[model samples]
Target: MTDTTAGTPAATDGGDPPDGSDFGVGEEGSDDPRIEFRGGKWASTLPLVFFIAWAIFQSGVLGIGDTNGLVVGALVGTTLGMFLVRGDWKAYADTIFEGMTQRVAATAIVAWLWAGMFAQTLQAGGFVEGLIFAADALNVGASTFPAAAFILCGLLATGIGTGYGATVAFVTLVFPAGVLIGANPVLLFAAILSGAVFGDNLAPVSDTTIVSAVTQDADIGGVVASRFKYAIAAAVPAFAAYLIAGSAMAGVSLEGAVALRESANALGLVHLLSMGVVIVTAVVGRHIVEAISWGLVVAVASNLLFGLSSASDIVAFTVTEAGALSGLPVVEVGETAGVGGSLYTGAVGFFPLIVLTLLIVAMAQIMIRGGGFEAIQTFLLDRVATTVRRAELTMVLGTATINGMITINTAAEIAIAPYVARIGEKFNINGYRRANILDANTSALGYIFPWAGGVLVGYQVMVGPDGLGSQYGPEMVVNPIEVVPYVFHGWFLVAIFIIAAITGFGREYIPDRASEEVSRA
Candidate 1:
């Protein structure tokens, strides 16, 4: 096949560089007919596919929520990649190590530091109390509780700009409480995961959201607003499903509604500033990490200077928590209660999740570099994605497939985003539209299947010992795992995405000429 002149910018310049060099355009040899689909390419995808199947069997079919299964899946997938590649075993092995070092090793290090600081700070500031205050305000019966929790948790994550943080907070605070109140714990956990999914995908301050917009060369607000329809499309059904499940599973418990409300109100729960600070900063288009970090700083200052907690106490609390999570030694507390308190809790809370995410990303990088992604891309572009509808379907399927393996929705977004943009551009899809679709599927699939990092994190909370009793006060009924069968929201969200993609409903933006810009370098 001869190289044809690739499509040029439509009147808007599409943000392509002056030479029309974005999207790898003008790169010679990409269109070479002899660039035959290679065995290495197919082999690359094998690990990811195997990983997905194994994870699904472990989490969905067997219902074994342990991290052991995930570890095994990664190992098996890695082995398959090595076996399939025709290259020397040492090269493949070196690639594996390199992939692990580059993506997994790097992210794990960064996430640990960030998690340590954020968790310690938040714990010191009594972030849980903030959640408790919000939960108390809802005061809904079992039937409506799931929806209420979903919305509240979603809003919290969006405001906080940290889905993982929200997961930890909600699991620590809401999971046990939901079980005690006769709301299904699994359903409740799923609601929390779904909420986290929402925030992670759309929150201006969410890491995934930031990476998607910035990497795609689009403005953050444009990405968020353009994604509004896709997000809501998935969210509405998720909301309704939660409500229905809450009703059937909860069996009309309203016994402690008034008391919970009164206690929550008595705590002066309406301050809203911590949440407000994060949200407003995001809305004003600040970098996501910077905005959330600022919120953390404010939260810490509030705790110490404003007597949210004493400075010495907050410091000690954070140190203790960080040590526990990292499996590092926590020194004996000298004088401060709060500082020690926060650190001890935060690190312990977020460590496992951060590790899991890093490993998953590393495995994905291995698959990509090994050539599995190219095989799939070649096939999809040539056969499946031949038309606009098919291209969109390919987009959906591609996003879903990558998310299934990677599990961390945000990480999955980054893994698959280049393809989404590339395929969408082929069909002249809009930038805003592509960004919205990319994020929406990332959010939806991340919470749908059991292997998803978000779901497992929540699931572990329900089945674990501390989760069932401490988080929920007296006054409720239900076992934690029993709620999984009733986790309606996760299922509903997937359905919504499928329907919208098929029907082309509520799509607002298409890629413009400017979308092809090299905003990042």
Candidate 2:
């Protein structure tokens, strides 16, 4: 009922999600030049180093807050990186192109494209509005609001598959309501982010999940199921924390919330059926792209049949003056046209991100070739990661270290995934353990950090024109910094993974045991 659901397709089918846990590579003895890095390890590392430095400066220092801006910076930086390629620029260029086109990056990109379309159509169908109605009917007060909000947002994030979307929705819609009913602003923001952490970590359709599974050479179904226990464990304490915080911080405010109940349509709740199809398909071991595409079809059909939106709105690819048209050929000499509606806008929203993912993968490939990955591997294996326990801890610490530097988690996941695969394999660590380490930090840090993609998106909604600040005033806006201390779920998830590594809670090894998989197709 928190009214968020302009979302990612959160998870695939869960045979029920628990405790968690590649890069693809070829034979070690092979001398294939294609697998080789042309430059020395130090030289190969320059591009990755450059990108990290640019990231630290851009998001951490300059505070530009533009995702696309980071992409541009990556482009320029990587091109400069090519200068360090010792031999022919042709081979270097080819390596970059090959990395850009590889199947791992392609799989996640395709899934995202379908997810965007499905999420948009679902939003058009009033899924979130129904949630708002649910909230109003419950009539939650300050003491119960934060906890309730966390649960609702968690469900919505699971259904939608996007923590960022959930954060924006909750921050925009539920935050004001919580504030009006007297929940602390910091606690409210943390509740929103914690819900995001739950969804992003558990959602099968999530990019982080897809990236973790594909990069580590494991199936998505196995990844989600194996990771369930850790998610629930962290969530239990997080839920209790929200409960206590909600009560302790309770106060009275005279200003009432803007009513969202009037806007919800009962028919919109039927989209839950569409969400079911996605989950069942995913849980049954279907391909993520196929699973989400079917969900998108259901969303479109539901929108029209339920009268949530019109056919024109579904494909309103109209040429108009207000929006600019660059790529489409529909423009005349003086006429400019643009697209609207569910399908186009939905899919298009992810284009930049998909490209950025590809470029980062390309950079990662360069690092692997140049022995940069091996160099880091040697350092960890020799000095820090001397034992299984130490190796696991190193994995956790290493993942956390990279995530802390990078702003967008999905990109950071891609960047660090190869190292996780290589290092974990050295200890014969299970794919699930490696992945859990890779993903837990990747998902957790993004929500906790002030400049993180998830947090920034939520904050943007809060301060935007129609946001809480505009509706109420500046006092209602939750600063990114203020909310960090209260981000209980993110912090707990990280701690759980670290403790899991040290204590051997949910660790497993491949070949010794196969992961739990979907039994039916």
Candidate 3:
């Protein structure tokens, strides 16, 4: 009988695995006690290799920058994983199931529930209008508009902790105005993405931030503080590019520019305190969902009692006629009340997000079961990563590669987290530094890859046939294929890390000898 756990030879120390065994891990046991090649290392790395190659082909060679290519990558990686594992297919299946159910599946469900509640609450509370007010209040020459827009969008995304949401908002509100005024669409889109990249990396409430801290066993504050440098380094250059691009794009000023200015000024103070509630609560280390829930309540109350919106109109916002509550009609608004409610908006916005989360989790499960994850991990640790610095680079490259295949940034982080933490611990790398590295790269690459959900969604909004592209033609927003060539920020961030790895710059606490000798909790 073959020993199923043969690939990775980890002695369960003095005790058996927590569930008594590895989820009924194959009954076959080998007593050889020799450093026998059970095939775990090479087995784990197989998925890594397949994903890297596939990502390059899909994004670089074939130039098919879509989710379709990602699905194909997942398939190829899974098949390769299964071919490497030396166990009964059933055992491999069980392991993968356990991994998915515990990590990705559980996290996604919670994230979506809170995501739905938060997104809906924000829309119902008129957050977007408030932003529009801000945009309208500012009337600058075309030259400085891009930089201002980029900074403002960055702030918005940082506050919301959702880059995709920020992208859609910026594209819809700022992009059109920029175009009408003769701003460079390609630079505008790049600026939007750059802002998003900043928030995704720095936001305390960001998914990548949460995963990196949790996986590396570091406090969120520490991780954020450590990563601040890298984010700034990448962002400054990107921001400057947008500013220069904005200046270069020529535009013909229009008549209603003054009218647009007035609308922005009118709603400038429309319950902005509601937004403050979210940012403050989040910074205080409260759970994001709970914070957003509080924000929602404050927004609704302020809208009604403060007369931000008519009471009847507020009611209309809760239940549209087309909804289940719609059939049981309630009061009318200023005229005929339209359907409205946080529930309505939240469900609409988060439905696709929930589906994406689940599908990605399932794909991850398939890769793990196929033995792809193990294949790659083993190969890197033993062969290429012969030193501490090499291991860190492996971590950086590994995070980037998985994200390209998975599309969901947080999912990719979770998938490779164990390996990252394990490798770091072996090399005495600081927890804070490790967490910072994980999040920085995850945020940077997830959007740059064409297959990434953020990129696809953003691309659709900016350049879809009937999208902003139709109204302005190619002049407004460049195609996804074209955007890749000019994604300087993405390339710059990657280069920064490569330099760090080679120079040992920004080294932090490397758990000392005394700390290293202590047992891992």
Residue-wise C-alpha lDDT for candidate 2, range 102-190, written one tens digit per residue:
55566556655676667667766777665555555777667777888788778766755667655755675567656765678778888
Candidate that scores best on lDDT? 2
For each candidate in the order shown, give its overall lDDT on alpha carbons.
0.59, 0.70, 0.59
Candidate 2 regions exceeding 4 Å error are: 1-40, 141-146, 152-193, 203-226, 246-268, 317-336, 406-432, 450-486, 507-521
lDDT per residue (tens digit) for residues 121-237 in model 3? 444445544555554456554566667666766775677676665565566556666655556566666667767777878887776776777666566666777788887787788
TM-score, structure 1 vs. true:
0.75
lDDT of 2: 0.70
Ranking by lDDT, best first?
Answer: 2, 3, 1
Residue 400 miss distance in model 3 (angstroms): 2.0
Model 1, runs deviating above 4 Å:
1-40, 83-87, 101-138, 214-217, 251-265, 268-272, 287-290, 297-340, 460-497, 506-521
lDDT (Cα, tens digit) per residue for candidate 1, span 1-521: 52333466345453443321221112211332211124645556666678778877777677676665677777777776666555356765665554454432343345334444554565445554554565555565455666877887788778766666566556655554454445665567678877887887778766566556654556666677767766676688778778776767643345554555344322223224555665677667665455556766776666655555665544432232334443423334333433344544555544556556555665666555655555667788898999787888788778877776677776677667767777877887766667766776777666666677666665544444334334443322233234444445445545555676678764433433344342331
Per-candidate TM-scores read 0.75, 0.74, 0.70
